[model samples]
Target: MKIVAVLPPVVELPEPSPGYLFNVERAYNLHEYFASKGHEFVTLSDAKESLEPHLADMSIFICSPFYPAYLTKELINRSPNLELAVTAGIGSDHFDLEACAARNITVAEVTGSNVVSVAEHTVMQILILLRNFIGGHQQAVNGEWNLPKIGAYAHDLEGKTVGIFGFGRIGQRVAARLHPFDVKLIYNDPYRRKDLEAQLGVKYVSFNKLVETSDIITIHSPLTDKTDTLFNRDVLDRTKQGSYIVNTARGRIMDTAALVDSLKSGHLAGYAGDVWYPQPAAADHPWRTMPKQAMTIHYSGMTLEAQHRIEIGTKAILDNFFEGKAQKQEDLIVEDGEIVSPSYKIK
Candidate 1:
């Protein structure tokens, strides 16, 4: 069987750094894994250039969110032999699930692999933006002392209402971490978690109410038709004035221009997170220089600890497939011509 893996390019170093695990050339060590099994494997760091050439014969493809190889309908139809696509970590939105299902390609990801990492990162971002840490840090680094300038915006997380969108594993973890901060928590989800709501001291609220009341709003939902651009002009306009927004989830969930406008108009005091619409955001993406916006590259889920978990989970998925075992129910995003995860939708 022929297998291919796509990953981001990594800096060349003598010793394998923690980042080596993300490099297609060094990570997964497919060569060693296949040596005894006599399977053919190839790994590529460039999807546009390297992936298309191998599609005709490839039987399986592995990729990660950090360096996603988008499997569009066109690409899916080209790879007649493709039977499976595995994500090395969580979040498989890069692939075209509709096409995958139509072509009988099983799609899987490592569920619960990096929720803690992302949840922790989300809370950190909320604190950074709420306290105006970036303004203070920039002043310090630039050899300027403006206590008033920084202090003007900085505020305590206590006594504030925070709204969480999407009540999945990561969302629940985020609420748990924030419980000790003495802030009110409200959540909006398609399904209600009455038991968890009671346990976490969180309340369920309508999406509009959450927007109007939240001092800080964080996104934890998946990217689907219902959620894509969910925070567009209309939604952002509905948010409480001077509110803060943090998105550790997918970037496409929030409209880039809408977020920028919200910040510019002072409707939102700050915006911070590590997710972006395009994985390797262009140098000139609007958010890069948007005032009062704090954005980072998509690295929240790729921490050293998360990578370790991903490595194990990815190996398990591959092993199960090769050994003819059923894919874990939670990990099967798309299987047998349909999407099984409620978080994912056809759109």
Candidate 2:
């Protein structure tokens, strides 16, 4: 069997990080493992051009959700030997589910690997926006101490109404972490987790209420046909004035230009998240300079610690496959010619 990994490169490091599992060059030290199993293994950066040569014969394809090698139906058809597609990190939206199902390709992801990592990052982005930490940090970096300039924008996270969209593992964990901050927390999900309300200090609410009332609305929803561009101009226009949005979820969940308009008009206090449209954002992506934007390349789930867990999960899934054992139920997104995970609802 042949396994190929398409991963994001960490070229910024001058020297190799033995523990940095996802670096294109090292591939988390996976080669020796595959070779030990007498299977061919290959790895490359997430360059579409760099992946073409190996498409036809790789048995299992591994990629990270942070910047995936989009497994479209066309690509799936092209790779005749792709029996399995693996996501080294959480979320498998990058896969064309219907295509995988049709092709009888089993799709799996490291489901619980990055939940805690992403949940923690979501809380940090919330505090950053609420306290105007970016502006203050800017003043310090530029060697300027403008007390009024930064202080005027800073606000307390306490006593604010916080709304969370999509209360899944990451969303619920975020609410649990933020509970001690003494803020009112409300959430909107297709399925209301009423049992967790008291335990997490979160209440279920309608979608309109979540948007209209939240001072800081952090999106944790998956990208689906219904949710793509869900936060467009009309939705942004109706949000509470000065509200903030932090999306650690997929980028297309919010409309791109509509985000700029909201920030430019000062209707939004700030917008912060790591996810973006077009994984390697173009030099001219508007969000880079949008007012009060605090964005980064998608890495919230790629911390060193999270990467290690991802490595372990990916290996576990592969071991099961190599031995003809069933993949863990939670990790199986699509299997046996159907989409099996409750987390995904693609038609």
Global lDDT of each candidate: 0.89, 0.89
My TM-score estimates for the predictions, one after another, are 0.96, 0.97
Q: What does the lDDT come to for candidate 1?
A: 0.89
Clashing pairs in 1: none
Alpha-carbon shift of residue 319 in model 1 (angstroms) = 1.0
lDDT of each residue in 237-325, candidate 1, tens digit only: 98988899999888899999988988998989999998887878889999999999778898888887888888888888888988999
Residue-pair clashes per candidate:
0, 0
Model 1 lDDT, residue 170, Cα? 95
Worst 10 residues of 2 by lDDT: 21-30
Candidate 1 segments exceeding 4 Å error: 12-20
Instruction: Indicate the residue-level lDDT of 60 in model 2.
Output: 93
The alpha-carbon RMSD values of the candidates against the true structure, listed in the order shown, are: 1.6, 1.4
